[model samples]
Target: MQPFVDGRYNMSKGRSAEGFDSLLVSITSNTGLTGWGEMAPLGSFYSAAFAAGARAGIVEIAPHLLGEDPRALTRINRLMDTIFRGHPYIKSALDMACSDLTARAAEVPLVTMLGGQENDMADLYKVVTHGSVEEMIANARRIITEGFHRLQVKVGGKVHDDIERVAAVAGSVPKGTVIFCDANAGWTTYQARQFVDATREIDYTLEQPCVSIDDCLSVRRSLNKPMVLDESVTSLEEMLDIHRKGAADGLTLKISRLGGVTKTRQIRDIAVDLGFMITVEDTGGAEVDTAAMAHLSLSTPEERRLHAIAFHQWVTVRTATNAPPVIGSRMGIPDGPGLGIDVDLALLGTPFFETSH
Candidate 1:
């Protein structure tokens, strides 16, 4: 699926793109149920994942799951890890498909399979893509007018540009509206520190200002704003390290980075136990990806659930339905069985791969 603004609007890792693309994996169970999954990398630069690598990984792992019980998500995830060594994002598609099938087997929604729903709806947030101060301010104003209370202001450019852009957005948005400046690990420790120092008087949150946990920790000491870790928190051990060190004020937990809902749930549980604020999301994707994230967000306590987005809303294609509706400032999970959305086989075209056991 292509983003509305293409690549000019989304910026990270010193790269920009015209549209986002993803690899979709569909598993057809013997019970005649189909489970869908999506793994989308934002032009291969935002994260370690790329579309090509994900497809190759799936080719290497799919045969192993040919006849395995779809409900054995843990076993499946472990097997994929044992075989692939790394590339959790690639394995995420399979994990999501298995979990979807498991929920279908139980005749329940994915959120119910995850756990009893703690939130009837999920709050939503918007991203103001990296741009000039005026453009970002305009974006912020538009998002706030649309009833969104939370905004993620993309930073990570030159320190002065980032500071000015952030300040502009803050000035434009309503007072008390939540604003987070996400650098996407685009800055050095010094740049991050400088921005934090300059923005000391603003009511804005900082997210992954630098690329490394150590660097971010160094900058954290000088900032009074809440700090959120995104690109740097990739593994369970890393998460534990952050928890042990009190690394940041919150986390941006992506389903692709941690594998899928199974591992994400484990991490979410830990985050809740540590009393850390958490937001669930994927790297980038269409409806399938959003559905998985929505269900996970639904299971999280509202107070701790920062916000999640239906990224598909930014795209032009309709891959699945029953996705969580964005009701004003909030989103809700679909009540349909399993993922609560149906993949449109027609849109997928001819299968690039197919096998039956």
Candidate 2:
């Protein structure tokens, strides 16, 4: 009762080495309005379980979406929300499916429909380079050549390791490059302060460095390093409150987590009005998801000069058997309607299980 895809890619072990057999998800609707999405089920923790749950949620709500206007994404989304409450991950799948389908149906890039004007440029950000000083330096060098002005490194879990990695990567970075750290809720505020102050030279933006949303607010209220909320600021109100409280100077807008593009734009406006910086980011899905995010990025404001979008580079491999949707790290939206992207249904995936249309 699910459409699953598995493929091979050389995943980076710690910026230098590579791992193989990476997997992804491709979701399609019966309307022939198909789309692709990724489920991060292999990242060493809940990624696997999380991805499975998302697939299950899609199965649970598929019947409700059958024959419905995928463009009326909110219709399916509302039903899924009310019918299957408390399954955020599953909601993510359904939301992404709708977005993917909607884009195809309208034949407009997701970014354009999401409200981006012409000539919108999106800058991509890669995962934090992990490993030795040499590896970190190498990875940073690679991304810089790829045209990413900002590099978001992972940290906040191991205080010393974070310091070491950021120190190494920071020094290795070329001049005028922006460096940001994503802790994934791995640090305490006190420790966060020390790390933030230390990495000040790296010009690192604090991203979920503290586990507690309140603590993040505490740090934002107290410090000047500019906290970026990735895990937090889930909804419109959350975005509003964070801005009102002056809690975060920036917010990372992830499509999969926040429902869909319609809602994504609301948060973007809120961020803009509050004078908080906003970057349309990824949920680390495959090319399609990256496309979705890119569309959002192109549609979002460039005043802050905030952009983090790169599709092919982020993934270890391609799932789309076709010429992987023509997209760029700074892909501009071609004039059209809706989330203009197609799912190569022929490459829906090698079947693990059959899902009848």
Candidate number achieving the greatest TM-score relative to the actual structure: 1
Tens-place lDDT digits, model 1, residues 1-357: 466543455675467765667888889899898888888887878888888888888888898888888888888888888888988999988889888888988899989877778867788899999887888888888888888899988989889988888888898888999988899899999889889889898998899988888888888888898999989779889998888887798998999999888999999988888888999999888888898999999888878878888788878778776666778888777778888888887888887777788
TM-scores, all models, native as reference = 0.97, 0.80
Model 1, global lDDT: 0.85
lDDT of 2 by residue, 87-173 (tens): 554565456666766766666656555665535555556654455667768878887776666787767556777788888887888
| Model 1 stretches with alpha carbons more than 4 Å out | 5-7
lDDT of 2 at 273: 71
Using lDDT as the measure, the top candidate is 1
Name model 2 segments beyond 4 Å from true. Answer: 1-49, 145-147, 321-329, 333-338, 350-357
| Alpha-carbon deviation at 109 in model 2, angstroms | 3.3
Query: What's the lDDT for residue 295 in model 2?
Result: 67
